[model samples]
Target: MARELLPGQSPELLKALHILTRDGALNADSLRKLKQVNHLVRLLAPAIEDVLARFGDPVLVDCGAGKSYLGFVLHELFLRPAGKGSLHAVEARPELVAAAEALAARLGADRMRFERAAIDAAAPPARVHLVTALHACDTATDDALALAVRHGADHVAVVPCCQAEVARQLGEAAAPAPLLAPLFEHPWHRREFGSHLTNVVRALALRASGYAVTVTELAGWEHSLKNELILGRKVRASDRAAEDRLLGLCAAAGIRPKIVRLLFPAGAPAP
Candidate 1:
């Protein structure tokens, strides 16, 4: 059962996080959850290391921290060992925040802190190195991205969950191209198409705001249905060409994603 814990992760910590059973055995669901976080941490290693090297004390913020599992695991596997970085988990739930803070205290994770705040309202450190949101439902993910941009974060990694706005809008939307209506003409297709389209808009929005983005899978479909991973690295202040593409894409779809309105104000200059 000790092997059920991730390397460098203490059994006590995993048990506290409820990722490991009381007896230290990992159920299938727990193992899948661990795998997802493991892959994300590995994928984010280079970015974290680069920030630590340059900033000396990098600040990493995790929004919509359900159960704060990612925050705990990331702190244990990355920040605790690095000794020059801190992680702030922003979660609206008072219970989760309290639990995470209590766990941090137990582990002597002095660098870890939990704040009770919504994704959109949370204020991160002045100089944020990285921002992460795992499985932030619907528009909450957009709020996290907006927070990152406002703070001028160096990197952003998010695994969005439950994209429903675009899908709901599509129910009443008439495709700009009549031939394209089949993409979302039915209820099932609309949900699926809306999720895909929402991610595309988000990526373009990031690119327009100066991030070089890569969209890929977070983990296998079997591990989680909400598996789309969007990684962004800040490259410059802005990309006007990308902004044009993003705006044009929204116009064509007749739907403005939350990211579009969040990142791009009406007639506002691109950042």
Candidate 2:
């Protein structure tokens, strides 16, 4: 009897992706990796369908694309079948970008392209339909969100990792809200509270910039510690209430993150 794979899931592509061994065997680690990305693809299916239904040809970007695994999987599961859009993988490392480009060619994924860019400097495609960042560390996730907002992207999804920037600032800054100072006065509490606050601020910032945000778990804790997924869909021009909330949160917390600076530089409105 032949081994069974998911429907329309190509073993050859999986082998090329190293998700499966050359002889088509799935290792323990590879299985875990595939499961994470596969689940994200499933979560994003509705957004893909919505963009395809609304637009003739869409452009999707993956920011801080490490090896472009998510990019390739997304293209394979969505763009390739539709044959109507492109997946642009943005990575800072030249070597990873080169390798991903070669892999795309080998897989005959002509529509998937690679670009070398820092998350903050990533250029927008002609029109951006979707933007995603997986495990982008520290403030890089903020850069990805800024990119999406600048382009007014139809959808945004990010799984942030190691939000150290806020934690570091929390240690140095005095709490404007005296009652809440206890939340981060200790080292352990500072780390945990800072991480939680970072995500909340991000969600509020997205809302301020006209996106309806959803925060959820990306996967089980066993799969990855960085499992928090922030998803957003464009809904309006902007929400001043959300903007005020974001401003108040930052002021009370006594921390101004990169996203706040990018979106509201010098206390001016977003462009």
Candidate 3:
């Protein structure tokens, strides 16, 4: 148990997070959590830097921010040093929000704010430059994506978790395509296929909303099961072809109409 420090990371902040004990020691669980936060920061830093370069004081929103770990790390390593950015962490749990607020106060993270609201209901007080949701459960990831689309954020990064919507749809109805029937035959297969399909649809939805999207692993499977990371950068125009493909996929997978409506609203061109 030694003081394993990440360059540019605040040791006191880590101590406050309980990632490191007061004696500067880390156990297995804390070390794993620290690694996870480090991985997230590494993945998101370049995009944040780009925004900072373009806009002197950009705003970042974290949806479904449980403990606001990502927001805090970003504030300490990126925002605080730049002295030109804001971090808003939105969470449904009031106690967690209070905890994050207290931590931010202790760490002197004046630029950070915590909201006790769900992803869909939370309103950012300012224009958002970037939107992020790490391991947002079930349809909450969709809420984050919709929030990005609605607010016209410059960038979005989300890692979706526990996607049961598609699986439930597939289980309720007969497979729309015979080829996919085998894939949905078993409960495990249904769950796995549903998760992959959900992300694909999400990427397509972002593309349709005028964002270039990239989907990749947030970390190794050994580190986390919810590893899929969807990164999006706003572009000039929406891709109609992507929208058509998304609709087609939904039809093939027998996804519910309500979900489709959530991704593609009325004004969005239909296939």
Q: Pick the TM-score winner.
A: 2
Better of 1 and 2 by TM-score: 2
Best by lDDT: 2
Q: Count the backbone clashes (under 3 Å) in each candidate.
A: 0, 0, 0
lDDT of 1 by residue, 135-156 (tens): 8989999999998888989999
Off by over 4 Å in 3: 1-4, 257-259, 267-271
Candidate 2: worst 10 consecutive residues by lDDT? 1-10
lDDT (tens digit, per residue) of candidate 2 on 39-151 = 87888888888998888889898999988888887788778888898888889999999999999988888889888989787776757999999888889999999999988
N/CA/C clash count, model 2 = 0
TM-score of each: 0.92, 0.94, 0.92
lDDT of 1 at 35: 62
Candidate 1 has a TM-score of: 0.92
Clashing pairs in 3: none
